[model samples]
Target: MKKLINNFTYITFLGYIAFIPSGPYPISVFGIKLDILLGLVLLVLILPKITQIGKNYPSIFLISLLFYLVTTLLSVIFSEDIVFSTSKWFSMLGYILVSILAPIAIDNYSKIKFSRLFLLVVAVVISFFIIHMALSYGLDKPQRFYLGFDPTAPANYQSDSGVEDIVDPNMTAIGLTLSVIVYLPNFFDSHHTKRRKTLEILAFAIITFGAFLTLSRTAILSFSLSLVLAFTMLSISSKSIQNILTQISKLFCLLLLVMIFLFGIYTLSPSFINGFFARIENIESGKEDRTDLISDTLSIFFSDNKNILFGQGYHITNPHNEFLRNLTSSGIFSLIAFLFFLYTLYFCILKKIKGNYWRYFSALSIYIYIYS
Candidate 1:
């Protein structure tokens, strides 16, 4: 019965991951969002075994998490709108709980293997679904997939009325980004059969194409940086020149194949390519830039002495940068706590990279850091 419950908990956790991209969509039950619902269910399932779960995690991780949670809660007292801040605080708590508890449920080698396979399957499914939807009903004016959103609706109409479901392309891209990062190394693994390698390559191509459709610069940049960093780490860890040369050859071949695939996409949809380049051009031209927002966020963060300690509170503003967001939402202490938590978490994952199955987790940790 205990084993059965753990398996169920792990499956629920995977469901949470699968729906992470759909977070902004208005899919709900009894007015509760699906992701929140899954999280709540997961919390309930684990509560009975909370002590057991807690025992598995490191002391530093738990201590940092607790401190982070406490700081966020404390920030709520200083919020201008207590009700809204309280709601946001609860949401943050859910995310923290999910992050800490979900992976602990995947205890052994079998679960680790299955989790990777599940994420790969999810990546392929998401890519196919988004690409098919985009091709069939057509992309929005921005040539981006507006999945779970009413493409015809005005931005203000969707935002003000709160009736139309909205899906942020950037968030959707993040899901694909994670999926790609987690399974990308498999393509280079020599243990796989030829057929398996071919399938993995196909999946990678489809997912990469889907990520392109989102046209999220952050997602694209994160994926690129993570891939480069992952390879660099692998190369550094390699014991011999022959192994390093082999990695380089594989990377070159992969890049060539990706280029050809992208060329094929451009031939099929020149407009899409144009749109993507236009986005890049806009960013380069400062027409669609975050520098101003980030600048303003910094100003607000340091405006008052009280804000320096307790922050302005939740739902204050979207800083877009996680560190800035934390600094603005819960002040310096929360930021410190967050940094500590991240350090411990990354350190833990770093230690596990020596194991074969843990490499994917290490890659994921790198991807999350870059993405953030």
Candidate 2:
């Protein structure tokens, strides 16, 4: 029964990830969101192991997270709209719970392998769906397609209706970014079978294209920087000159293949290339900028002394910066807690760099830092 419970917990966790792209239009059964239902079920299954969850993690890291949660809760209590704040707080709690429990669910090599494979499959399906939606809506459509039940906007776009479940393009891009980074290291390794290599290459190409379709500058930048960080760390960890040389060669080959694939897509659809470069040019020309938004958010954050200690509450405005968002919404205490958590997390990943899952975690750490 214990074994069965573990299996159920693991499968439920996988189901949660698989439906992440469908977050906007969450599937429901008898009015309960499927993802939330799965999350609750997962929590119940893993409740017995809660005490053991912290055994492997750093105490400071856990402490900082607890502090962060407490500050967030205080913010929620002080919030004007308690319902909205409570909902948001619960969502965050669920995310934290899942992260803490994941190691227990996927405790072995075989489970890890299966989880990665599941992610690859999920990425491929989402990529293809995005591609098809883009083509259907025309590449020049004002709004990009997102990962959800429907790519098009709803007829009734009410903010509170809960039916206007349009997932953000940036969110979809981030998910694809993660999927790409996860399988990217396989290209550097030499032991994979030809079929495995081919699948990885195909998945990588398709996922990359899908991310490009989102035209999210942050996602693109994060993906690029994460790859560079991963490569640099791997190079530094290399023991011999020959291994370093081989890694360099592999990197060059991989970049060449990516360029060729992207060029082929450009030849097929020049509009996508034009649109992508136009976005970059807009930033360069100051046609699109976030400096004003950042400045405005800072102004509001500092407008009141009390706001500095215990924030003005959540979702006041779109800050577009995670640290600023936390500072403005939850106060300085939450911000410090969050920063401490990340600092410890970075060291935690560094210590494990020589371990089996170093490559994935290293890339993921960079991704999280950039995204945040």
Candidate 3:
């Protein structure tokens, strides 16, 4: 019985990874839609080891999460649409559940094999998506998939990022960035054969290729910053020659990946490089929608004293900035809770983890902040 439960746990994690890239999430048990990943994660948390997992997580993070949940509930009570607010609150809870459970589930001791399998699965999914996008670009059938969103919407046309069956292209980029951070380092550290590393490098390269196709400035900028940060952090922390060489190899591989990305763009779509630059041009010229979004959100935020404290409500929809979105939707209390939660996760929980785990987590945190 115990062995069966462990097998189920591992299978659950694999299923979650498989579902991540493209999700309609149409499955629901009761009336509540099950977040497949979080559902599996929660199952993993049900074991006897769950107590230790809880203890392993930072106390500050747990406190902040509690506060955040309370604030979300309060926001729902005061919200215009209770249904929407309630749904969002539950979703946030799922996210927190997954975040806390993931580190515990993939920790160094018992579940390390599951962790490797999860990474490999994610890497394969990313590779498949990159191949699909390349074919889509070459054939020029549909510009972008825009999955789970209205294709005919004006906003769809405004954003040139390659969404490719993901809810949002920017989100796709963020996911890919995270996969790169986690797996790329392993490519360096793994004592796998030359052929195996080549395959891994191809996967990483393809992931990078997908990121460029998104043309998401935030994604690109955040990924760049995270790489530099990861490199610097790894370098400073390592005194062993093997560790230092591993860091250097990661940097070299990254640079090579960029070169391959540029060449791929030129070969596949010669004008893509220009389009990417045009996007930057628009941002620089203050023509980007995000600029106006920030301005308008700030105006609404300060428009009323009540909103300044409680928030404009979740239905406002277009904040485009994560912190501001939380501020405008949930309220100042939620925002404070959120900031504290992030601080604790990165500074406390991530820092407490030994080995290259911290490097990957730090990169992920940086990506989340920038993508937000």
Query: Clash number for model 3?
Result: 0
Model 3 alpha-carbon miss at residue 8, Å: 0.8
Quote each prediction's TM-score: 0.86, 0.87, 0.78
After TM-score superposition, what is the CA distance of residue 129 in candidate 3 from its true location, in Å? 4.5
lDDT of 3: 0.62
lDDT of 2 at 29: 71
Candidate 2, residues 158-208: lDDT per residue as tens digits? Answer: 345464455677777877767656654444457778998888878878888
CA-only RMSD, every prediction: 3.1, 3.2, 5.1
Q: Write the per-residue lDDT of candidate 3 for residues 17-65, one digit (tens) a residue.
A: 5444333223444544445544645554544555675578667777877
Off by over 4 Å in 1: 21-25, 137-141, 152-164, 184-191, 237-239, 284-287, 357-372
Which model is ahead, 1 or 3, in terms of TM-score?
1
Candidate 1, 24-139: lDDT as tens digits = 45566887777778889998886655666557777777788788888878778887677989999988787776666665656676676666667778777767767886787665
